[model samples]
Target: MPDLRLSRRRVLALSAVATLLPRSGLGQTSKVARIGLVQSTTGGSAALYGTEQKQAIELAFNEITKARTLGDIALQAFHADDGADRGQTVNIFQRLIRQDKVVAILGPTLSNSAFAADPLAQQAGIPVIASSNTAPNLTKIGDFIFRTSVPEDQVFPTVLAYGVRKHGVKRVALIYGIDDALTRSAHDVQKKAVDALGLESVGIETYQRGDVDFSAQLTKIKAQKPDAIILGALAEEGAAILRQARQLNLDPKTVFIGCNANISAKLFELAGPAADGILVGASWFAGYDTPRSKAFVEAYRKRYGTTPDIYAAQGYDAAYLIAEAIRRAGTATDSRAIRDKLAGITDFEGVLGRFGWSPERDATVTPKVLIGDGQAKVFAAAPAV
Candidate 1:
């Protein structure tokens, strides 16, 4: 409950010159601006995430348009399904830039898809606000690339620290999908945290993205008898790993931890009783008591008949972020103006709390650590030392 509001210094200043510049030659002739939404709505790994992201983007865009926030300019959305294929993602991105003439794009859900697709958008001079790509090196792709979701570096260590201090976790086991760039990056981050905290890494294991059998990895993890197990896989895989580990006599006392991937209500339903003690790090949860957050949650539930997950929350923020940039630029058609506006974004608050872009083009935001019982509820902030 400490003062989490952004300070005045963090607010971006719009200079008189940038504000007064003439838009006559900046492709401002159009009365409507188009934003392309790229998501993998048909593929196995990303279908659920993509559906949620699309819904959230549409909700935010509708809200903005209904408020007439952009005056006479109409905001239109163009959606393309990536199908969870990197090649398809690249192709669709090119189409969005060349054919639809979208000023900005909201997603390509998977981090690997972003790695493949965002470069094309960057080279084409179109800004992309990645809704759910959390791997390292994403923002480092280029100045045009930005992500709304908190990265593993921002999420992991606190959860690890909590495990060590609150749950008495010392020795740890790590498991992740080696085939996935995002999961691999998460595993690397967890390893670094273990080294930094002087915690023993008892066992490290890897699995393929679609593989169901994890007996080999679980058996290895069981032999380690580590104090905690950290998983960098998505919800389905992570839940299965937890269940298999428990069945293999892995200690129930051993804490189970995951990153943003496990921040879904589906995990509890999927993993059943095995998911009782899991801890997940996240950016937004429906349990936030703020008026804005409560309203968003209520609206989302009314529309979708379910609680919004992190992917949905990030997608909503990304849409508003793009809309804010376009509004400041005075025209959505000017790529340079929009890019500049995006970089100067500061103190924009949303369902996720204070949102701003760091100089590196990464989102500068803190994460909340939530422990999943039947739901992922906020773990009370650790008392100050």
Candidate 2:
């Protein structure tokens, strides 16, 4: 955990250098390629998740910058704490664009922040890639807005389908936070998937963003005795739901399925034994047996002193994808050119698996399922449709 803070003078100096460098100087001159990272550092139960995400981004940057081949394209990163505030996110993005003049933008992990900063990036003609923001509306932002992480529209359907098909789940209860865009999107997708499968959504419960108590929601859900309860919220709400469900002694034989946010180690820490049997669906797992994945996991652990989560893996993959796009475009100077190159990516052997992008779906990689108790195992692969 090296100190991630950059001094004001250093940021200013770097900003000045980035603005002054000519387009032709990229990858040939001494000027470093600056990347602006905006992530939430306050409020949400997922704040620690954001911190872990930042650590992963820095880890990838550190590894890439240290490589001899990347010497010409020094990867410098600037971080902004959006605190899950949309207004703060917009303000920070404007600052990064107007003041820092970053070549690309990396995050603002939540969908709300991604929604806010994405348009700003498009307006400024810079490419913005999100690691974890999964709201369905995010993909519609513009060509400038891209997400390495799978959108909820893609993730939730697969999760629900798996629960219904593979696990033989008949009835499901969904608990979601109304204020969170990702959760709402997941709920909608799950609802559709459940209906399509001819399974009953016996229970549906809602909560506010900052609400810690899910007793009422859990009480309602527990009474339904559905075959499974799908948690469609961030880490904090998910943890609360588990804790309250446990406290109520409402352990339905029904399996507990969770969205991507439930993959966080903090969720297990917060929920303790209650989180043991929880099922998580995600695009990448650090524990995957692939050589590239193993190496990435080992390097990330060596650098950060903890196991890397999917968010970290996604960040690393996003950086690598950006670098590859730069390589294909033959220069890092033109953001639009780099974006065009990225849009054409196919069969990219990334840590997350082979990445292929299309206008209809940005991610072509199949997602994996894992249990929260111990090492994750792939439950199923999403068939290429």
Candidate 3:
């Protein structure tokens, strides 16, 4: 019952509809809803993904506002960059909640940043929808915190299971970032999945977030000669590892299982042909053959002149989710009301497909798996996970 009206496609052209609507001020009674958008738009490893997220969010807001999706409530966005740093993220959260007086907030891109920053939003009664952070226990921060990005635990297992069935993977090695909440949680889930699937553990290696040389880890993993390697690192680190592994002359048949972060196009750019065999667990993929997902992909390509990835898809859905929550709450200014309505959303047709909240307030959607294209084009769909 959490407002399904906005999910349906609009019949009227947005330009045509805009002409009939009144302005926000100057004798017009329409209200402007201020929302804060936080992400690592620059000065961080997540900058590429963050930049795309910002672009998609702005695109979604443009479309929503043009269509008058929230009726009289026109959205006013206040975007901030946290540089993917925890310190900057917390300060931005405080500033958005207290100074800007935003009813809701989205992002603070990395999971470590979210862990450090979301508590402040929770204390301030501001609802936050995470477009990118997918570490475990994210929503456990409070009722006020939610995420359009599904948790690592929910999707990684399915990815591994699919790998086992299709690739006949048995012995698996693991590598992950120890310093990041996202990578750490991804590691934990991948390990758990490995154990549950009764796969042999040949080696487990760890690295810091910014390390470039994975030669030592790859050498050790190569000696073990596992059927597959599970990666808990993001695209940048994962790319480095893949290139180094290829240089080390690891087995050609060895498969690579990557987390949600490795779905970025930057991975292929950095790793070159070394990225050919990766299978990534993700919340969304560009070529998904569903109505909502296809529409989103086509719209995004039309607007941005580039195909949308998982990050862009996440941002677009997050914007609409917030807009829908605002509409259902009936008061754009009430943070608590909006939070409640957002948590109550049981069915939302998003680019990620039929989106909903898990009991943990994390996103619940059928996860998609992506594979390399044997060329520059990567991330084609594998079966749904």
Task: Report the number of the highest-TM-score candidate.
Answer: 3
On residues 263-339, what C-alpha lDDT tens digit does candidate 3 reach at each position? 77677778888899799878777778889888888888897788877898998999899999999988879999999
Q: Per-residue lDDT of 1-385 in model 2, one digit per residue for the tens?
A: 6323324434644553444333344556564666777766565665766777777776666556555345466556677677677777787788788887787888878887777678989888888878888777786888887777887667666667766666679988988888877788877877787788888889888888888888888888888888899888888788778877878988546778888777776776677777766776788876687888899989888876878778878878887777777667766567788778877888788888887875843677777766666223222333322
TM-score of each: 0.89, 0.88, 0.90
Clashes of each: 0, 0, 0
The residue ranges of model 1 lying beyond 4 angstroms of the native Cα positions read 1-30, 375-385
How far out, in Å, is residue 352 in model 3? Answer: 1.0
Measured on C-alpha atoms, candidate 1 has an lDDT of: 0.79
lDDT of each: 0.79, 0.74, 0.82
- lDDT value for candidate 2? 0.74
Determine the backbone clash count of candidate 2: 0
List the pairs of residues colliding in candidate 2: none
Error of 1 at 138 (Å): 0.9
* lDDT, residue 335, model 3: 91
